[model samples]
Target: MVNHKKRRDLTTRSVLIVNFNNDLPELEKALIPLNWECASACDLKQSLRIIEQKNISVAIVIIQAGNELQVLNVVSKLQHTTPDVKWLAITTQYPIPSPYLKKKLATLFIDYYHTPIDWGLFSNSLGHLWGMSKLQIESKKEVREPTLPQELVGCSEPITNLKKDLKKVAIVDNPLLISGETGTGKGLCAQLIHAQSAREKEPFVIVNCGALPSSLIHSELFGHEKGAYTGAERQYIGRIERANNGTLFLDEIGDLPLDLQVNLLNFLDDSSIERLGGNCPIKVNCRIIFASHIDLENAVAEGAFREDLFHRLNILRIHVPSLRDYREDIEMLAQKFLARFAQDDSNLRFTNSALQAMLQYDWPGNVRELKNRVLRAIVMAEQGKITERDLGLKLTNNNMPKATPNRLRTEIDTETLLEALKRNNHNVSAASRQLNISRTTFYRLVKKCNIQW
Candidate 1:
């Protein structure tokens, strides 16, 4: 059932050979007959440049026994930056002398070979790797729809029900209340509602009640006249005015001051707001959407939040599920985040072990935590595969098999790397800490790039 056209198209991609120490005069000649376009790089730097300039699907790194450390340091760095390339490490030592070196080799290479190479076996593996790389690229395209928001990317029961609820409420102009755990994408849910609503063309303004200073809460929500306070320099238009004829999303609504709740309730009751230091009420025709991680019912009983305001804001409600609540969507969400965060066209895949670890973890931080873990793994993963260790999640049980990890794919631009180092004062440990990666990995990357601290 193999389509000839697909097979031909797949073989058109290039293969790069990086010569670190080993010599193979017949390697390129043998590969050309097998339908591979061969490119050569004398060193790691040249190989990286070739990968950047060409459509390389696989890289063959040739090294000798004594040069493991030098070759691996540069190889790991290249793997981190060019995850799309499936690397095959070919060495002269038949039994790979050092156990430590073998371990590193297994972690970083798709496959490794010794001298007197088996041409048939190597060619087959290379073709298979190239096919997988192409499949990953196509799979990414298939999973993502240009029109849908990332928050709405899943098909789990909870997300399906949430989408239905959003559709039902989108046309309604009543104030909406969304409750969810922190990092569960409540803001994105609010945005989806706004986008689907009648006010899609108008501005959608967001205000974090908990993040704003209490002193400036009033001025931030409502407009302020010039000379309203001691430091009032000029007339200021509040977020409400900016969201006129659109939607206003108030995040962490439970954090609004008690006095401000009265003003907010009044505005909800009569679509109007009184500017600070002004006597007139301005009619604002904007739909209000409120989201909070804290339970407003509990807050009301605690005398911290007004019950009247709670009822007013709770006319329409949506509760976004936490990551642990619907474990079925974890893989989909992880893939979406990986695609979103990838800086280049690298073919990166999650190993079976990594996916198993993700499924077993409690995900206390929900979607946000999963996203951050994937982002960090992209930088720290050895070879091109992301493993459970790379994701910083330990397997819960001993029953889980530790499969060969796949390369963690993402190409973080050099500028981001330099800036991270700069922010941490050229200290490798501090720089890696800032990027949430280990000092050892960051140090290798720093050394490979010859970046001056």
Candidate 2:
């Protein structure tokens, strides 16, 4: 038995005891010395009600020798209802008779004690379980704090409007279609919707339709039974099934093949799917959020995409704005990225010229491109300040005279211009920024100078 004087702190800690066959007195006597409070439930149903009503970190289940099957059923339901609570089982029989019952016992209990209980050891175990449960609860709280929708990180009017739309969409369970240019944070928008939804605690599974190979796409999205195909070795759970009771984000929805689109539409309509080579239909409950950079409407009109499927997914829609449209937030975004990626050098900062260049450049790749440039600059910068040069922006004379209103007559050195173009990976927007000339002027200079690499 635990020393009564040493366990004065246990008075505030309570444990729920689910008794079968009036097995509470001995356990009560053992726990009393530790100054612990106990709540008793005669059956599993009552125990579940008690758990729902109270704050329970641990449970003690007293089981009779012959009622293992009943006990197992009750315990299984109780475990699912109060998954955070740690359960400790006590059996009167030292050796459980059946192998199946013993296996079930192992699966249900976090720890167990035999009838001729070692009171001291059991008390110690309870304390350990309580400590672990508290730690786990705190860890979960920490994880949830960072995933809030405010982390989406934009302040422009388009971003503000999008956030409002996300909040409205999150309240109702509906299939959502998110359309945006590539790298315009469509995936992030889907994540925000999931985080803000009622199913935030459940899984958030992402499927990149474009990245999956055509041959494996069907099996990958809908799963496959063992021996379903030539390479099958084991049964696999598909993304839709895995996201049951949560959210499923399908990125690059336009890239999903026409045949697979039919299956997807069926699943969306019925909330069920049939595995490859499996006859039975399995039901899944998950919110669907589809993202597409391509013009899906165009695909439908061109007969490349199904019109019916497009209409089904177009129920609720959100259009994420490109970074160019929200240029006001660039500096804020750069600072946020710098804070994340420049932890090793707290003093590092972006120079005014660097910020100016960033504002001037048309980010064709959107936020993704900005993040990449900022990350690269953090690594490549040596003077503690990130400059336009560090970000691959060149300084050119913008005041150069033009031979014609729509053309350039200034003779830009061919080798110098080619070097700048090569440095910027031949990206016209970036190359023009480096040369400090307008994109139109740069194009005309290239044509007039007849520069070719």
Candidate 3:
């Protein structure tokens, strides 16, 4: 036994001693000089209750020669229930234990001490365990509470409604379908849902169905065994497998080939999938979120998409509004993008005329287009203030298009369309005639451009 004349301050530290024996008093006496607090329990049940009631970070279990089995059983239960609590062991007999028992003890405890323990070494080990426990707690806190990226930047009514819906949907684990026009940030909405979900700490994988090559879409989604196909060098784990225990965001889901849609539907029906070449079914636990700009109902009717698959995916739906629907947020969004792109150029500001032009012009490309224009203007603007001209907007009242005969015939110029609309007093039929395009084509352009009357 060792003794110290000077008492060190360690009131903040706590340890639980289970099955304490005659040696416990000596240990307590040694710890008291270090100002360490100790709680003792005669049984595992009592120890568990004490652990729950106290903020003890370390536990020391004492084992007698014949009571090894009892002590080991109790320690195993405690280890499962309170994994965060670091454990140490003290035994009266050492070399007499069975090999299995010895292994079990070694595996469970950070360190073990036999009879005639070194008091100095035991004290240092306890301090080390406490410090390690603190570090692990801090690390878990950082992982569980992360600062997510800022993607949704608007406070408009539509945006507010969307946020409310997201909060409600996040708590429930189900397949979500997001429908909107192109560039409406459906992918971002998927990301927001996953970030707020219970599985936030898990993986969030994205797959652009439209971007993947038709020949490889199946392989990419369902993975492939080694030598399953030509040019296959090694086994591949698909996106769905990669997202297990988390979320799988499939953007432009409408573009998935009809043949593959059936396979996807089967996977959705039963949370299991068969790899491209493998015969065995692999179970995957991932929340599926699908996004499509095209109308799935129309696609189903046209035989371009499967009706059953469409209905299955449409169970939990969210429709993101086009940028024009929330015009109130355009200025704020523009300013936010300006700040992002301007960087250290603090003096850079959008002119009143530039803001007015942004409000008046139809943003067909939605938020994506706005971001692009703002980024372009920041690089192109010569003066401190970004003007309407810098954003490629005509200063005239009608904002008519400057004639460009060589421009693509399929491309509908913003100025030309706006001038036609103004000339026809926003009459859809007359505007279509003025542009010399069919009514359907004209209306599509209007919708595509996000033109608002």
Candidate 4:
């Protein structure tokens, strides 16, 4: 367990670090407000004890590529034992080559610093994560346990807003139309929005509009009466009725035939449906959530999707931003996936360089591609840290990340400081209050950074 200094010695600004690699100078340099300095964990058991005892809000890890399994174990423990603690990885730049390390690291760890830690960006991401932790505490009433919303992870501004949007749409009963590129997690977003809604308690029925054959479309959606047609064995419940008082998720809604679209449009407009060969109109009290990889407007122009149906579902539209657009979340999301399902669940971790490589790619498949690489690393890697090699990603011949460097650069310190200041509303005194430091000390540091008064 970490040794606790007096309340005065370790204030609200205290941050706990878990590093198997001993680098006192780097660790100390990372600390702000010496009194609220970082705490070290000697071992996994010791780390858990320290985190539990100190109420450590953030953890920084300098993971060894070889001991990937041990690192994963420590990370897993941190996630559960200190559910609220912010985690950061300070490591060598990517090309890490271990599958065990890749999968485990991707699951929960957020943010990373390449060799010669980019102090500015590192500080910012850390502060952002810290701000999120504070928000989790202060807005406990508004906060719900995060459940991997839209496959977008991290506390970046864009993802945070998307999360808010998901929550807002979850409460209403309006039809939600989620539009995103293929494999960008439209179905997942639909499920998330549904889970957050009033209809979450009821059955969540999923229908792959494109996959359902034409002959069975009507019966599958509205069910059929006993002996309704040649193969009708008995009365069957349709996807619409089955999802009564719940959510009906229509995946790939663009592929639904025109006639079936009319039927679906009728149900959406009137909440009533009649089964094939059945006389009674069954009333359904449910919400419809739909996903489309293609542009509905273009489809409508081609006389494919019904314009009316599109308008109805578009009432609460949410367009999930591709991972490439909000690039800050790449490493964080990669780490989250790595940690959740790695083979060497305990010892596997990602090398910093590997994360840098991950951040460089323009994810055409978005989260899905990221997931595939991490999964591949988990199954194929042999080293402790999973690297770009393990992820099977190669840099362009020109030796640069696929995208421009600016997008890959994350401002760490400013982000963290701003988040802290925002949480405390630029009040140095209030910020100092949490760090258990004197206001004068806080001002001196703020002055050092030339931060506005």
Residue by residue across 237-303, what tens digits does model 2's lDDT show? Answer: 8888989999988877877889999999899889999999899999999999998876789889978
Tell how far residue 348 is off in model 1, in angstroms: 1.4
Model 1, span 349-401: residue lDDT tens: 78998999998876645787798788767756666788898788887776533
Comparing 3 and 4 by lDDT, which wins?
Answer: 3
Error of 2 at 359 (Å): 0.8
Best by TM-score: 1
| Backbone clashes in model 4 | 53
- Provide the overall lDDT of each model, using Cα atoms, as 2-decimal numbers: 0.77, 0.77, 0.77, 0.70
> Model 2 — which ten-residue stretch has the worst lDDT?
400-409
Query: Which prediction has more favorable TM-score, 1 or 3?
Result: 1
Estimated TM-score for each candidate: 0.58, 0.57, 0.57, 0.56
- lDDT tens digits, residue span 1-453, model 3: 112211222245778988745445677777767756788888765776566555568998888867778778777757755667999888777674678768977799998888787878888999999999979964652232233365788999999999999888888888999988656888778878998999988988888776566888899899999889888889999888888999988877877889999999999999999887799999999999998877889889989899999989889999999887888899999999887666657699989989888877766567877876776566457669898887776455765234334233225445556766776555554555434343444555566566676
Model 2 reaches what TM-score against the true structure? 0.57
What TM-score should be assigned to candidate 3? 0.57
Show model 2 residue runs off by greater than 4 Å. Answer: 1-150, 395-453
The alpha-carbon deviation from the true structure for residue 292 of candidate 2, after best TM-score superposition, in angstroms, is: 0.5
Cα-based lDDT at residue 412, candidate 4: 27
Off by over 4 Å in 3: 1-148, 395-453
Q: Name the better of 1 and 2 by TM-score.
A: 1
**Candidate 4 segments whose C-alpha is farther than 4 A from its true place:** 1-152, 397-453
Clashing pairs in 2: 394-434
